[model samples]
Target chain A: MNDTSTRAPATRRGKGLLPLALGMVLGALAMLVGLAEAGRLKPREPQTVVALGQLLDAEHRRVDLMLERGDMAGAIEALEALREQPWPDHEAGGDVGMQLRHDVYGRLLRLRLDHPEVLPVEPQALLRIAEEGLGESYRELDINPFTARLAALRGEVLEQLDRDDDALAAYVEALDMNSALLDRELAEEGAK
Target chain B: MGAGALLGLSACTAKAPLTAPAGGVDESAAGGDRDDASLRAADLSSLELELDRSWEELRTLEDSREPASVEAGAAGPGDVVDRCERIRGLADRICVLSDRVCALADEHPGEERYTSACGRGRDTCTQATEAADRCAAG
Candidate 1:
C-alpha cells in the first residue's frame, strides 16, 4: 500500500512537471517571436526590385508603338516624359537602369533628329542629352551592344546637324563596336 | 539513442517547403524555357545588318542638299520608292522572326535577356517599317 501510494504521487508530480515545462517552452517561443516582431533580428530580405525595370520596358514598347502609328507628337511626349524620370538608384553594374536610360535617350535623340517639328527641345539639346546619357560609364561597364547602338544614333544626330566629319567618325566607331559585339555573341553561341 | 540523434539532426536541418512561382512553372521548367529562348536569340546579326544599311541610306538622303547628287549616293526619289519597298519587305520578314522570338520568350516570362532581345528586335523592325512608309510617301 505504501509503495503504491508513493509511486502514485511521484507519477502525478511528473505529469505536473510536463505542463510546467511545456508552458515554459511556449512562453520562450512567444518571447522570441515578439523579439522578431520588434526587429531584434536582421531585417527581412527586400522585395525583389523588378517593377521599375518592367515599367521602363513597357514604356519603351509604348513609344515604339506610337512611332509605328506615325504619331510623332505622341512619341515625343512619351519619350520626353521618360527622359524626365529620375534614374533609378540601382546597385552598381545593374544593367536594367542603365539600359532603360540609354534606350530613352537614344530613342529621344532619334525622334528629335527625325521630327524636329514635334520635339519641344532643339535638336542640339537632344544630341547633348544623348551624348551625356550614353557616356563612358556604359563603356566602363563593357556594355558594348548598347554603346554601339547609342553611338549609331549619335552619328545620325550629328549627320542631321551637318557635322559630316564627326558623324562619319561616330559611325565608324559604332560599326567597330557592333562588329565586336557580334563576334562576342557568335562565340558565346558557339560555346553553347 | 540513435533515433533521438536522428530526430535532433532532422529538426536542425528542417527547411520551409519549396513552392512554385505564382504561374505554377517550377524552377527547372523555367530554366528549360530559358534554354529555348536562347535558341531564338541566335544569329540576329544578319537581320541587324539589313536594318543598318537601310537606316544609313535614309540618313544619307536626309543629309544631302542636292537631290540629284544624293540620288547618286542613295536611292533617288524614284529609287526611294523602290528602296522603301525593299525595307518593307525586310520588315515583313522581321515581323515573323520577332513573333517567333517573342513566343519563345513567353515560355519564360520576365526573363530579362529574352524580353530585351525580343523587344529590341521587334521595335527596330516596327520603326524601320514605319520609316520606310514615310520615305515612300515622300
Candidate 2:
C-alpha cells in the first residue's frame, strides 16, 4: 500500500465490449449470407415469360424459313429439336409457355400429317404426342388459336388411327375455340 | 315444222311470269329482327362443323398453294394477307358462334357453363382480334 506507483486503477474499460463487437459482426455476416442464398444480392434474371415468348416467335420464323426453302424435312427436324428441349413446367412457364408448347407441337404434327414420309410417326404415337401436348388443364384456359390448332391436329391424328368418335370430339373442341376467337375478333373490329 | 306453227306452240307452252310471294316486304322486315334472334339461337354443333370444314379448307389451300412471297424467316406478306383472308372467314364463323354463346350466357345468367363459355369467347375474341389486326397490318 505504501509502494510508489504512477499506474491508473484497472477500470476494465473494454471488458464486455469484445463479445458485443464479435456478435454484431457475426450477425451482419449471417444476414449477407442469407441474402446471397436467396439470390437477392445477385443481378436479376431476364423476364422469363417475355424472353420465352420471343424465343417462340424466333423459332417460328426459323421454321418458316425452312419451309420457304421447300425443305419440309428440315422444318420437321427443327420442330422436333425444339420439342427435345427442356420446356419450363406450368410453374416456371405458366400459360404462355404452355401455349407456345402447343404451337410447336401443332406445327410439327401438321407437318407430319401433310408429309407422312418425312419423320414418319405412327398413328398411335402421334395421338400420344397430341394428348401430351394438350395436357390436362389446357381446356381451362381461354381459347388460344395455337391450342385450337393443336386440338385439330389431334383430331387429324385420331382419324389416322380410325378413332372417328374421338376425332370428332377433338374437331368439335377446336372448332368451338376458333369460333369463339372469331367472334371476339369481329366484336373488336366493329368497336374499332 | 312451220315457223309460225312452232312459235304458236312454244308460246302456248311458255311458262307463266314469276311473281313475288305476297307479304315479301314484310317477310324480310320480320326476318331482319329474326336475324339477331336466330344468330343467338344458332346451332353451335352445326357451326362447329362448318368451322372444321373451314379449317380444312384453309389448311388445304395453305399447303397446296405456293407461297406467293417468300420472306427470309417467315411467311410472306402475301401469305400473311392470304392467311388473314382465311382467318377472317374463320373469324366470321367464330363471331357468329360467339354471339350465340354470349347471348345464351346473357339469357342464363345463373348457368356457370354458359357464363364460362361466354367469358372464354370474349377473351378469345380479344386475342384473336389483336392477332388479326397484326395480320392486317402486315
Cα lDDT tens digits, model 1, B21-128, are 212333233443344233222212221222233332322222221222332454332123344444454444345445544654576588776576567657755765
Off by over 4 Å in 1: A1-49, A89-93, B1-138
DockQ, prediction 2: 0.03
**Given the true complex, what DockQ would model 1 score?**
0.02
Model 1 per-residue lDDT tens digits across residues A1-192: 011221222232233455333332332222223323434211121111123433554565465456557677887788678767666433431433454456557656766666667746755876787787776556543433345557777866676676655655565555445444434433543576
Error of 1 at A127 (Å): 1.4
Residue B84 local lDDT, model 1: 48
Which model scores highest in TM-score? Answer: 2
